[model samples]
Target: MKKTLPAYLGISFVWFSAHFGGGFASGRQIVAFFLNHQWTSLFMPAFSMLIMGLTFYFSMVIAAKFNTYDYSTWSKKVYGNLAPVMAPVFEIMFNALLVLVTAVAFATGGSTLAKAFGTPYMLNTVVLAAVIFVLTIYGADLVRKSATVVSLILIACIFIIYVPNIIYFFPKIIHNFAAVKSGEIVTGTQNSFLDTIWWAAKYGALQCCAIGAYIVHAQACPDKASLKKAAIVGFFINTVVMYLSYFGILAFVDQGVLKEAVPSLFVVMNGVGGAWMTVLISLCIVIGAVSTGVALVYGTTNRLANFFGRNMSEEERAAKRKIHCISSSAMLVIACWMVAQLGLIPLIGKGYGNIGWVSLLLLTVPILLRGLGLWRFAEDVPGKVAAE
Candidate 1:
């Protein structure tokens, strides 16, 4: 039952698509978290790779071993008696924040389109939400396959935007690299090297909650060894994307263009092949946002359905899941439209920055403890849950 290399690649692509939302694709996350730090930005990829790789490996191992693919059951295994108390709190906070972030991504993508082609923001939002809603309703397999296809195109577009610039701007970037200094503030706060490390680690950990459902659903690898390979492969893919994005932004920092809201777009507008390339990169950004939006919405609905349908008959459960998906998607689209009115920068700073740090303690710490063998589950634990 071991998954083949292609299976792992497909799962990894889904994970990458889900995790790399509008913030990342727009270069805002890179500018705020890494590029603002000057030369220290170079260290983020390794730190992110370590934290995210371990998180994925352990989460998948737990999912496969315990047959607890939903967050509620997974929390029970991790937190024991605290599961009842933590489940609702974590669920509300995690899903709400994810929805808010995703909504902002959609809004940003819409606004980007509006700027590009004079399209109406409302129309763009409707089209984006509709696409995600339809894709999610088809469920995880479709989401995974759609994400893989989108991710491949996304990677290609990113290289087209960044690689040539990195080559052409090589000397200028090198000359400006050491001249750049630390102490540049990002998101209204200054970050030292240690702060950057903390931010990277926390961001990676926060992703645990966001990607939990996908990791659970991607249990194609039946054995620990194969699962580990999938996680490693996923990590590499993620790290490469991060590296390219970070350096792509860093390559043009001396131009002062990083000050823009969408630094990657600014870079493409200035450095890449211009109008046509801008349109292509813009399409890539919208696709990335859509991929992330679908994943979050689907994951949130799946969690809700599993929680409410826990004791239902199989037929009833199936019916309830359909209802939950439709209702939740509709509600999410409306709520996201409203919240996105608050704008993109505030959402990323206020929403992700605070919630991300909290997840480090709630999700990452416990999972790391278990992975390190410092914590143990009872031998009968899996059987007890399975029997229930």
Candidate 2:
């Protein structure tokens, strides 16, 4: 079961697609965290890469060595007596957040399609939900494989649309930076350097909940070396795509033309290919949303089944899981549709902003402490003698 590089990349693509959902795909997060800060935001990509790389590596290692794949077991192993208290808290918050974000994806994708094709927004939402439901039913392996292809296509399409914009707009971007430094542009609330660093750290920490299951999936790796390498590769791929999109957004900051709900689409629509490019960009956004929504639903369903199906026979468990998946998917779609009516910005700001801090305290801290050897649990490591 020694995993090859392609095997690692395939999983990494899943990790990337899962995370690159509503906020990242839509360019709203980049605007809030990075683009708003202008040139000072350049450092975020590197800082994010560091935190996520370490987190992914350790998460995979712990899952492999401990034989715990789900977050409930992993948290218990890391938190000890606090597992009862911490596990439910993490599960409830994480699952709810996943539902909220998936809703955002549906809203985002639906709106984009509506603008592009003049289709009814609710119709688009229904279509998006159906696509995610089908994908979730096929389960993780299919999602991972399909995501690999989608991620590659996204990267290619993004670069084709944005790289030239970066070159053509480089001068304007530099000028805008100068204006901001001179206090002439009035770019609104500005974060101090330290504040920017903290935001990057917190954002990276929040991603652990989203990708934790994928790390669990990484347990298929035959050895520690393969797992570590896969994590690193995955981290780099995510980082690179993030920065490329950031730069794309940055290029348009000076012109003040990025006022649309989907700023990335605005960028493409105004760039080389014009209207045709917007259609292609719209497709990318929808696919990104679908990938993200499917991952969230799959993760939520998997967690619930693992939590409640512990005593069921294998056949019984499978039957119950199917029921759970279908019901959860329907619930998520309805909830998300209701929430989407409130708009994307509010959903992301309120939902993610609050959870980010909790994750830092509960999820990230315990895992980091265990991974760094600063804390150890007697029963955490599987296959080890109690005395050892």
Q: Candidate 2, clashing residue pairs?
A: none
RMSD of each: 3.4, 3.3
- Model 2, which residues run further than 4 Å from truth? 1-5, 181-184, 257-259, 314-338, 341-345, 380-388
**Per-residue lDDT over 146-228 for candidate 2, one digit per residue giving the tens place of the 0 to 100 score:** 77877888888777777777788878767776777666764545768777777777777777767545754664563667666
Worst 10 contiguous positions by lDDT, candidate 2? 379-388
The best candidate by TM-score is 1
In model 1, residue pairs whose N, Cα or C atoms come closer than 3 Å (at least 3 residues apart or on different chains), thus clashing, are: none
In candidate 1, position 381 carries an lDDT of: 45
Residues 1-388 of candidate 1 have per-residue lDDT tens digits of 1243266666677788887787788888777666665467578877876787787777777777788777767767776666788766677767766667778778878887898789988788888888887887766667777877888888898888888888888886666665565333233234577887887777787677675556556455546776677788788888888888776777777677668888888888888688887888788778888988887777766766676778999899887787876776677666776676666646466567677778887777777887777777564243322212
Q: In model 2, what lDDT does residue 202 have?
A: 74
Candidate 1 to native Cα RMSD, angstroms: 3.4
Best by lDDT: 1
